[model samples]
Target chain A: MKPEEHQRRFENTDTLINEPIMAVDITRYCDWLAIMFYYGAAHLVDKHYAMRKRPFHPDNHSQRVDESRRLKRGNVVYKEFLLLYNAGLNARYEPIFYDQEDVKELKESYDAIKSILLTA
Target chain B: MESTLALSQSYKGLIADSILNILPYTLAKDQSNLLETPWGRHMGDGSYYTYNLLESVRQSIVDIPWWTIGESNNMSQDTCETELLDRLINGLLAFATTEKVIISQREESIAFWVVSSALDIMTQKKYCYFFADIVDKEFDTEYIFDFRIVSPSNRDLKRIPTDAQVYVRR
Candidate 1:
C-alpha cells in the first residue's frame, strides 16, 4: 500500500472512531455503537500489525483483540481494549439490550483506544 | 401476457392468535415524554427493563388471528420462529421513532445473536450458539440466523476461548 492509501485508511478509521460516537443517543443503537467502537480499535491494532510485519486484518474483531492481548500481555491496556471489544461484540450480536452502564463502558473503551490511535 | 402468481396466506400466528388485547401503553413524563412503561432490553433506548418489554411481548401474542401458523415449509413461507420474530421486532419498534429501521451496515454474526436470543426466550429452548457461520446471507444487507451462543454475563470470559462464545459482561 502507498502512503496515500495508508492516509486514506487512517481517515476512514478516524471517521469510525469519531462520528456515531458523538451521535450515541439511545441504548437501542448500541449494536451500531459497538461496531463503530470495534472498527476504531482495529486501527490501533493496524499500527502494531505494521510494526511486526504482519498483514493487517482490519475487519476481524476477534483476531485484533487476541493479538492485542498477546502483544500487550500482562498489561492493563489489554484489559481496556478487551472491554471495548466485548462491548462491540455484544452490541452487534446479542439480543440483550445495552443499558446506560454498557454505553458508558463503550465510551471509556473508545477513549482509551482513541488515545493510542491518535498518538500512532 | 402476465402471470398472476397464485399464493396463500398459509402460516397461522399462534402467538398473535393467542393474544387478547395489547397492554395499554401510556406516555408519561419524567422530564421528557416517556412510555408509561418505558421499553428496556435493547429494544427501548434505556438500560434496565423497569417494565421489561419481553413480558409485554409475551402478553401481546394475539389471542386469535382467526388463522393458524402452518407447521411445515410447504404452504406459507413464514415459520413459527419467523412469525414470532416479526411480532417481537414490531413490539420493540412500537416505541421507537415512526421512521423506518434500515440496517446500513452488515454485522451478520451479531444479528444472528440477536435473533437466536429472542427465539430462545419465545420458545423457552436453550439452544447453545456454537460459533459457526453456517447460515447464509442472501443479500448485502440481510440478517441470517445461524447457530451460536452468547453468555448473558461474562463472569468467566477469560476462562472460555474467545473463539468459542460471545461473552457480554453484565
Candidate 2:
C-alpha cells in the first residue's frame, strides 16, 4: 500500500473508539504510525536519489552542493522530505507537547511528502 | 570594571531565577525531579548553583578590557559587550529546553488521561475527573495533574471519596 494510504488508515484507527482506554491505545498507535510514515518517506527519497546515480551527501548543506547537478536529479524534493521527516521525528520523541494542531501539521507534512514521492 | 561585573552577575541571576520559576510548572514532574535520576547528583531545587554558574560567566566577561576608540567617551571597551549579550541569549535558550520539557509534560498528561479513563470504566460511571501525581522517567520530573472526561454525566457519590495513585513508566 502507498504511504499515504497507510497514514490515512492509521488516522482512521485513532477515531474508532469513544472509550478512554481505547483513546489512549489509539494515541500510542497513531504516534508510532506517524513514525512509520516518516521512515517510508525517507526511504523513498533515498531510493530516488540512488536511481539517478546522483552523488549527494544528505548531511551536507544544500547550498554547498552544486545546484545545477543536484536539481537535475530531483534532490530538492528529497531534501525537503528529509527535513519534514526530521521534524516529525522531533515531534514524536522530543519533550515537547503535540496537540491536535501539531497532528494537523503532521498530516499536512505527510500529504506534501506523499505528493513529492508520487511525482518523482 | 567592578560595576560591569556586578551588572553581568545581575543578568545571570535574573535568567537563573526565571528558569527555576517558569520551568517547574512547565516541565513534566518526572523530568524535573532530578533527584530520582542518575544525573540527580548535579541538580538541586534551590537557585544557588545556577546563580553561581551565571555569576562566574558574567564575571569573566566583565573582566576583559578593550581599547576605547576615539570620540566614544560614553562607551568603554569591556569583555561584557556583544559576547555577553550572545552568552545571555544562549544561556536562556539552553535553560528553556522547551522541546524536552514540553514533550515530557505531554506524555504525563496523556498517561493521566488514560488512567482517569480506566477508572471511569471500572466504576461504570458516565464521567469522571481526577487529579493525581505523575512522574516522567525521561525528564526525571514529577507533576500533580488534573485529568477529566471530555463528556460529562450525573453520577451519585455512593461512598466516601478516596484518593487513588497510578504510576506509568515506559
* TM-score, first chain, each model: 0.67, 0.49
lDDT of each: 0.40, 0.33
For the predicted complex of model 2, DockQ is: 0.03
Evaluated against the true structure, the overall lDDT of model 2 is 0.33
- How many clashes show up in model 2? 16
Error of 2 at B11 (Å): 18
* Recovered share of real interface contacts in candidate 2: 0.00
**Model 2 bad stretches (over 4 Å):** A1-28, A55-83, B1-170
B104, model 2: CA deviation in Å?
27
TM per candidate comes to 0.37, 0.30
**In model 2, what is the error at residue A111, expressed in angstroms?**
1.5
Error of 1 at A97 (Å): 1.9
Candidate 1 chain A lDDT trough over 10 residues, lowest sum: A69-78
Across B144-169, the per-residue lDDT of candidate 1 in tens digits comes to 32222244343333343222211111
Listed models, DockQ each: 0.04, 0.03
